[model samples]
Target: MVDFGTAEVTLEMVQASQIGMKALGAALAVGMTGIASAIAEQSIGSAAVGATAENRDVFGLALLLTVIPETIVIFGLVVALLILF
Candidate 1:
């Protein structure tokens, strides 16, 4: 019976709607963050590995790109914490 933002649909009447929605939201939050970080780090790792495989002069750029995914992870974590807490 709870009203979520603007939706007036009743979960109590919908059986598994409430739980499903909660799980969905949690999944979306974490999944999106995880995906973004994975994609970012995947590229960075590939580039760094490729550079290492080729030569040792690309260390700085590799390190920099490797840490770039951290910002997205932090943002996702903060959002998840706010949602859970």
Candidate 2:
């Protein structure tokens, strides 16, 4: 068995670790939501394109549907901001 050296934990070290965790959390929140939004937009965009091609009248609705997934990214940004501040 290998022996591990003992290390003293200080208040500064604890605070630094907490800050790092907070930053990690904020990054995950934004990155995951952005990925999810991209996935959602992919399917919606394809369907929207098809619908718009079939009927020009549906273009407005299709546009709205395609854009709906973007809201998730905005929400992620808000969450990241909240986590950081």
Candidate 3:
């Protein structure tokens, strides 16, 4: 912006301001939770499946293993809330 003879600003300039790190915040939040879930599920699911495969009498073990991954989500939710608040 200028006086009466100011040159028009370009679209790139207009977009550059909003192109800051705001996007990274969401990406990191989501990425962390997603990674946590993936890691948890992989470990728990693999253990559960292995227990079930190793012994048909291991349903309790499998169940416990399956539920173990849930803790990650719970913990993540808590952390996310802490961060958000």
Candidate 4:
């Protein structure tokens, strides 16, 4: 085992920590956005189903609305990519 108690901080250590933070940020960005989108879609999906059930004509529109929340996930993916690379 290596002891870090008396070790001096180096540039490489700082860079490594920065990279780790970036990775953590990227993961958080993707995870939070995915959860948010999922929550949004859950309510929207239920409402859309009810609307579709009442009127068959609104089925297409409901489908489109349900898909709209998915864009948040896409945006999250972009942000994660930006952070990671």
Candidate 5:
């Protein structure tokens, strides 16, 4: 047993801690997904640009592929919302 102070823990304190944890979870969900989306888009976008430069006819497909990674961010936002509320 360690007795160094007389700090009292209350219900409000516990509730606040839980809220903080939920916020942290939500932030991590969104942050990590955004980072992953950026990384994915970086490579896909470069490839799409190269493909588009090679042949203008491929522009539509390349654009579609490049935009696909953005859905991950939307998914992340949903997860974050779920975590937060």
Candidate 6:
């Protein structure tokens, strides 16, 4: 029954909204990183497979290169955690 024009925003409401925004940011950080990692891995995996086929000795180097892109996801998770906490 409160009048819309007379309604006032409280500090708690502002804080709650801030928390929600932070959560959204965290989710975005993780989601984008995961997507990027997948894209990077797709290309790297194909290249690695081709290289490995050319030289069996290159398997170790190819594996290392393929795994390097995974660090993006790990960093994203860390950023998300920081945003949430």
Q: Which numbered prediction scores highest in TM-score against the true structure?
A: 5
- lDDT per residue (tens digit) for residues 1-85 in model 1: 8656876657675767756776677667878998989988998899798997788888888888888897887887777666655
List model 6 lDDT by residue over 11-68, tens digit each: 9999999999999999999999999999999999999999999999999999999999
Error of 6 at 28 (Å): 1.1
Q: Number of clashes in model 6?
A: 0
- Please tell me which model should have the higher TM-score, number 2 or number 6: 2
Task: Give the Å error, residue 84, model 4.
Answer: 1.6
Per-residue lDDT tens digits for candidate 2, residues 1-85, read 9655697788999999999999999999999999999999999999999998999999999999889889988999899999899
Per-residue lDDT tens digits for candidate 4, residues 1-85, read 9777988999999999999999999999999999999999999999999999999999999999999999999999999999887
Off by over 4 Å in 5: 1-4
- Regions of model 1 farther than 4 Å from truth: 1-23
TM-score of 3: 0.52
Candidate 4 residue-wise lDDT at 13 = 98
Which number leads on lDDT?
6
Candidate 1 positional error at 28, Å: 1.9
TM-score result, candidate 2: 0.89
Per-candidate Cα lDDT values, in order, are: 0.79, 0.92, 0.71, 0.95, 0.94, 0.97
Candidate 6 backbone collisions, by pair: none
Candidate 4: Cα lDDT at 6: 80
Task: Give per-model CA RMSD.
Answer: 7.1, 1.6, 6.7, 3.2, 1.1, 3.1
TM-score ranking, best first:
5, 2, 4, 6, 1, 3
lDDT tens readout by residue for model 3, 1-85: 5486767788988776545444445456657877887888887788788888989899897887777766766676666555544
Name model 2 segments beyond 4 Å from true: 1-6
